[model samples]
Target: MERVHSDRSEQLYQLYKPLLFSLAYRMLGSVSDAEDIVQEAFLSWSERRPETVLNEKAYLCKMVTNRCVDRLRSPGKQREVYVGPWLPEPLITEALDSDSPSGAYLQKESLSTAYLLLLQQLSWVERAVFILREVLQYEYDEIAEIVDKSSSNCRQIFHRAKRSVSGLSGMADTVPLKSESLKALIEQFIHAVASGNTGQLMNLLKADVSMHSDGGGKVTAAVRPILGADRVIAFLMGIASKAPADMSFRIQMVNGNPGIVSYIGEQPSSVITFRMENDRIAEIYIVVNPDKLKHLPQR
Candidate 1:
């Protein structure tokens, strides 16, 4: 009987693992942390008798959501004085690279680096409620159950989260630049930076573009966001001047969008992603922390 129950629990976990992981990842923005929460949730499930659970999916979702909330409320000690900017850990989802037209926008928008960054503004509960309601299509009652809030309160939280991030929700998707076009833009920008062509770089950016770098205090990076086209160009050129002769750049798909990865003699140095609006670059995110890039698969 115990073996049968265990088998049943494992089957259910497989069925819901992706959904649960997506929820946790979106909530926490750290692949390892989300994986940890999902694993612990499965362990909890394995210890329970199947008969005691009324709805397996809801039960698992609630467990994962609550765990993520706890993690958010009390972040890991290492992050207390994280150096420079603290961008979300990049996730490589190759499946997104070959998405079908019908689901392309939906998949791209949901996991885009811009959307994930915007999600950081909300409180844990509000983030949970907003992701469950807006992104995952969960009903208020279901979200309330997951977050331990009343349905009414969950609805209010969702509304507030929605309003807070409304203007930025489509920051990365509004332009819909073709993949080839995006690659071309990235190449053009790279060439301009390499040659110290400030005029060319400025033409590639929107008027109010910003650059953000996360060095996690392990390496050198901008202590604050660099804003405006001129300032961003200057920052990029300054970093370029310091680049080692052996450093190389590779075009890669990062978080379901076009991104550039920098390599310093086979060591991953940094990952850069651009957000396009009105046929120009609007926002730039660069992650240079060696600690964050440790998850990249070896070449």
Candidate 2:
């Protein structure tokens, strides 16, 4: 009987791991931390008497959500003193196939650096409630159960979070460029950067384009955001001018969008992701933090 129960628990964990990881990742904005929370949740679930739980999914989700909330509320000074702009660790999403639905694209957008940064603006509980209600479409009562709040209170929190991140609410309504077109643009942008074609670079960027670089104080990076197309172009050109002879850039799927990863030899030096608006690059996120790049494949 004990062995049978163990087999059942493992099956449940496999079934819910993706959903739990998604919940924890959205809540905390850190892949490593989210993964840790999911593992811990699984361990806790295994120790409990199976018959005592009414719903396995909800029970697992509640454990993951509450752990994420607790982690966010904890006093963490790492982000407080983080060097330069802070960016979420780059998430390499699965390539979209021809049969992929539009909803899959939108889901990938939510994982973008820009969207994740917007989520960081909310308070711990607000972030939890908002992701549950908005992204996951959980009912207020279900969310309340997950967060240990009343249904009405969860509703209010969700509304407040929605208001705070209203800029991103239109994400679902806006149709993104097809994957092929996006990849073409990324390739063109990369070529322009490599060849020092300032004119081409300027044409690709929006008037108010902004670039953020995160090196975590361990490497050279911009300490503040570079705003406007001209400034952004200049910064890019400067970096290009100083790039080592062996450094190379490869385009890859980053956070569900086409992005460039710079390699110095076999090690990844930086991951660059763009946010486009009206067919122009609106925001650029460059993550060079070694700690964040550990998950990426070498070579």
Candidate 3:
């Protein structure tokens, strides 16, 4: 019956949809693109008989991954002249419980803005191999099938990708800063800026700290990275000094990490996430691009 077939199709879609979305999201930093790819995959699945799928999970994953690869290779040139420093779209994963194994893995490995930026350095196949084998722990043979490469070639690609991102890969295994610790840090940071306490702000930042903000040319923002603690602190203080009287900041999960979200009235002005080293903040990434923030709830 038509009803029976439709019900079965919906059931199968529900079962594997989350994992497929997660895979696509990691492959492409855009949540909107990932959702679109997942929807396309589901449409394809609906055309096939559910009974024919012996391994629905792997089948769905391959569909999404291949789509992401094609998307990456597509002739999209928007990022070429992007305003200011380019940054990944911040993904809020606060609903996921970090205590679970899957939650812990995603938070540490693929969801960080820094890790996503590093992934951009890899070729499409290399990125797929690295994510599938290293992050997801897929067997080489399985990854080969998904990527259409021989298992031996997949191994070589994985090693190559590993060497290319070795320095940036370590953060994937370490724990994110504790929520309370991050909240305290942001509070201290906000207070220092509000009080014009340069010394306090400088102490919180590493000497080699770098600040990058992406405003997508639609709003006012720095056109290049601000390096060194002194310059970065001055930049923050300058922004704070000119901030609107009604502006406020709140802690929110951005890209599976704690970050400060600034708002003016009901509109989000900026999202700032950090990369810490040796208990001090080493890097700051702020996204004020209106296009990227459209997915975020205004409140």
Please name the candidate that would achieve the greatest TM-score relative to the true structure. Answer: 2
Per-residue lDDT of candidate 1, residues 1-299 (tens digit): 99999889878876777778778888887878888999999998889888898878888999998898788767463455777777888876654524443233225566777888889878888888988888778999888777788999999998988988886565534757887899899999889999999999989999999899998888888888999998998888889899999999888777777788888888888889888998899999999888789888654
Better of 1 and 2 by lDDT: 2
lDDT of 2 by residue, 1-299 (tens): 78978998899976777778877887777778888999999888888889999878878889998898778767773478777899988876644452434234234567878888999988878988888787777899888888889999999999988888876544545567777888999999999999999999999999999999999899999999999999999999999999999898888888777888899999999999988888889899999989889888887
Ten-residue stretch with the least lDDT total in model 3: 100-109
Cα lDDT computed for each candidate against the true fold: 0.82, 0.84, 0.82
Alpha-carbon shift of residue 219 in model 2 (angstroms): 1.0
Flag regions of model 3 displaced more than 4 Å.
51-53, 98-105, 168-176
Clashing residue pairs, candidate 2?
none
Question: Sorted by TM-score, highest first, which candidate order results?
Answer: 2, 3, 1
Of 2 and 3, the candidate ahead on TM-score is 2
Please state the error at residue 108 of candidate 3 in Å: 3.2
